[model samples]
Target: MVNECAPKPHVALLASPGMGHITPLYELAVRLVTQHNFQVTFLVITAGSTVAQDSYLTAYPIPDLHIVDLPPPDMSNELLNNMKTVARLCYIVEQSIRPLRSVLNGLKRPKVKALIIDMFCTGVFEACKDLSIPVYSFFTASAALLTFSLYLPTLDCKADGEYVDLPEPVKVPGCNPIQTQDLMYLVPKSMINEYQQWFMHVSRLPMVTGIFVNSWEDLESVSLKAVKHEPFFANIPTPRVYPIGPLTKQAEPVLTKYEKETIAWLDKQPKDSVLFVALGSGGTLTSEQLTELAWGLELSQQRFVLVVRKPSDCAISGFFSAGSDVDDPIAYLPDGFVERSKGVGLVVSGWAPQVGVLSHPSTGAFLSHCGWNSTVESVKYGVPIIAWPLFAEQGINAALLSNEVGVAMRMPMVGEGGEAVVVRRKKIESVVKAVMEGEEGKKLRRRAKELQASGRETLSRGGSSYETLARVAESWNIET
Candidate 1:
């Protein structure tokens, strides 16, 4: 193994205050501080920041890991309801960058080498530019997704309305022709016109020295190659793009007492017999969708564990309920679904021990929303997946897992005008059954094992990801 600890470097990771963003950043922080002897300060804000605090509290502690909190914005409305509100929050954060910059400047540590910021937190890059602090953009999504985002300028020209003929499968510079479906979540057609301008502006930012993606080379070789050959990215001489994943593998399981019990239950089950189902922390299911999912799980006749936040109006009584706030749409899961499947299933409310459950020997398959983190974690464990992609890049991740990776089966997506659509129960059951028992399922399982083996090999001594991390660390130049 490379000696990441030999030359200790001080680093800071700035995350967009969300679970999806913070979790990977936390894992990276852990790896840098523990494995590479780098001192890291994790910058966070009030909203959605508690998740990171809780996670770090439960995990290994590093004396150098500092949490710098920015004051909350004075707003009553949810940012999800309005993009403008999100932009305003970003503006406020941008204003707060000076204090952060001052703190970084004051860090007495001589080896403070680099600043890693979330892709969305462009303010950090702008703030630290004059200091010569090499700002690396950490993309939490797939390499294919990044490539697709880069090509949005081209896709925009060809687009007519809601759909566009997928640009020909020409070889992209750093990637292969990622299937159109895999790129579907790149930018929603509704937001493309506006986002295209944003992408264009951000792509030219000077502080973005390198792009660090949380993916492995073997998994995204075509896309990685495309990124290398792209013209727009050619001039950023200091910021090289690197793929260092699957990051989930580096995370140690830090389950709570409740999570430990869940793992114990999973252990009692037959090897590869249990299916784990979870939507990410932020995803919400409509009442109708919830019922269908419940019915579908029942029909699959598989031993399963479903994690939900709340029960819907149609939900049957006597099931475990997390009692989330009524107004929170996610709190509306169907009741009694857990009781009906009692002996055959377990329904965990609130947060789940996702990594621990997935790594369990009894876990045969994952019924996931196809979030990139979940996708990589499932692949890491060699768990066959029933892909039920929801919003964002989830659908794209599902497509790659099912069609490209050959290790997962995709559930049919229903709905026409985006928001009005939902995946039905019948289709969910069908896909689950196919993934759990059919010949295709067997093939996917075999492929999953092969991928899992490859992941292990890549993380071993002299592996591509390992070498990439070492190279990036050595090449880093601290502006202090």
Candidate 2:
């Protein structure tokens, strides 16, 4: 009898044209090639292509790895402008599918067996359908977002002007009832309609085999179950939805050069005394907001490190000032605020290694914008949070942390000129002080510690996420 088990299949990944999307896909690609021996080819285009190529070459230079370039599209500029144009970019993305198909048809090797695609790149599945390549959709957002995306049509039906008032709680397949407010509303109304159409068309593609999320099962078990039970998704063979994250596992243990400096500063501070504040790379704060935050941190009299990014609005002076030029953010901060609270604060502007800062022993609490990646990282390190969600699904995640999980507190915001604005300086000061030294803060901190332990146990040898990853690798006949 001849042995029938086949060699690992060649896999191609089509990532969204941004660092946020490309980085995680690259990490997964590295794991696929390094540990599983899959022949991997990554498709790249435009400026982000250069970054993808550089990262891949530095991380994995094996002969089996390949990079294919696609023609740059005009809409690439718009894609980078804002989240609002995402739906318009889809038309441009659809055009690339044919070119990608031609490239894949010409590949000569272990043979292209599977396609791992970013959730936004639904065009790939339509183009590759006849080739019988199994395409898996990877969602970087939480399962709740996916659930919301799937039910948008229903929400559209119930919309009133400017807001959709959902009754009690809307139940989504495979997940618990979610409040209407939890859904991400960053996309414009017109774009939401277009995206809904796009999703409907793409979900019917025959080649789509599964959905993979960058989350851990333990963290999102309820949402995962809800996703599995959807009727529309029933006919489409639901590919194994695995929560393989916090993707930071593969990042080298050695801290980045900048991180080393931040850590060194942290070392001199008392244990659990610093309040670490940062937003994701894309987050920006107005000068007014910046001044308020500075005063708040100073008022708390807590040792702190704040990574402040440039403001997005052009009207603001020093809007894009790299913090390197100034000794203190307080120079731009409100007058006399720094003098009043001299010893309690330190501000590091622009980029800082957020994970490194959060993991430091002196770091007792986090004031964050509540991006999912940051949320998971904070939980992993047992850092309690003061959730000040800026946009996207961040508000949803913040709600879960503050209300459902009891691991975080929400900083109140007020609606101004149709947009939700952060609370005033006095409110900011009170909240910061409460999170840093109050009994409520202590309870949240304890809960965060428990959540952190759960994450560790889940990522350990036999944890749910660990097993899910193992099964996913095995299903592809790739060695774990």
Candidate 3:
């Protein structure tokens, strides 16, 4: 009898440990199976659960995709609460590699082609290599950062010691200038080793079969150009880079009460009249900052819907904190702010349907934390941004959105600190007014509309991004 258990044309997708990391890879897996014809095995490393994990996959019921979840590793009672978050995250994710390898034990057929991994979980590259499965590093961050990363091996030679030692705002060959402030934002004093380790992992890309970037050409032309055409100093060529994205979440109709209420409020508002405020799902603020934000939104007099993750003393929540169960976020707002702004502003405590909100006709602008996912979502929906970057690569993303993309205006953090940059009521009011109704806002809206059109065209069949993604599957040399 013929071997009926033979593997199909399979592409394994690896997701790391956070909502930010997992969601994108999950969406990519779904897309590969739905949009492209590839058979996908989505290998998620689940170490317990996260706040966003509760209802993360409420959409996308694709039948063709097979999901294998590797259990979280058991650890000693020496909990990682005090460990530098960067290292802790990496350490936790690395535990899944052994199980992932075991899961790969049966995927040895000739057609079992490639593994597309979240860059953070690149530890599995070794496993893929050992299994002779070609790896493609899928990055969810912006193309600018990808370009910056591609130049890391070169930057190491130029820097006297650490990247921080290269002075403020180091300029890469073909990309934008990167400030030491932003560098410090990504790799603070405590996480230097993790920073170096990240670069070390990134340096492994050339050895991989390809790199998948989540940005389209029009969105990040220069950055994409630099990565593809502009070679690094030593003529060390990079692998095939695919700009197959704006791979943002497609709109799925939401049914929750909060979503319904928010949508109702938005529908009642005037067209292009509301400022949709959300600092990504993981972003939290101090009470004082929250108060200031309330005052700013109220004082600005712009109609708005702010998704409030309960204000926290923590500057920002861990890359993903399973989120707290806050029944009411209104109490944290300035006195009567909610009451006064009634019918004018909506405060969505806990999670709101973001893609739906941005696509609404009432959405005038988004006060975003400039997380790459959030940034892409805003851009993809044609909403201009009020860029308030909190942590990670958000600062640079904010800068890129404002300076390079011409689709947003940067909001300076309060008191020159990363924690609360004390956005006062006055500044908040002015900034809100400028972005919502002022001339700059109109110009930004136009540019954003242009970008939205470009994204749609590129993502459409036969478009550049679509063609690029097609090639990625074809490169595996296997039939769907």
Best by TM-score: 3
Residues 220-337, candidate 3, lDDT per residue (tens digit)? 9888888877757226567778888787777856777788999888988898999999887677778888888889888888899988766776645635565444568777787788
RMSD of each: 5.1, 4.8, 3.2
lDDT of 3: 0.77
Compute the lDDT of residue 124 as modeled in candidate 1.
Answer: 65
Candidate 1: C-alpha lDDT? 0.67
- Model 2, 98-214: lDDT tens digits are 577678888776667678887668776656877777788777767666666656555556664333244456665556666555543445354565556455643543345777677
**Candidate 2 lDDT trough over 10 residues, lowest sum:** 314-323
Q: Where is model 1 poorest over a 10-residue stretch in terms of lDDT?
A: 314-323
Rank by lDDT, highest first.
3, 1, 2
**CA lDDT of each prediction against the hidden true structure:** 0.67, 0.66, 0.77
Per-residue lDDT over 1-480 for candidate 1, one digit per residue giving the tens place of the 0 to 100 score: 666555456788877655666777877887776666566777775543444345543466567677666655555445423443234335445544546667777766664577888766776655577677767888888887777666555555766654323444523455545444444544445675445535653454445777778888667666677678767546433256788887873444655655666777887889888889887655556667877888888888988887765543322121111223223323454566656787788867655778888888989899887878788888998998887765567766776677667888877663432333567778878888887778898999999999898888886668887778777766663333
Number of the candidate with higher TM-score, 1 or 3: 3
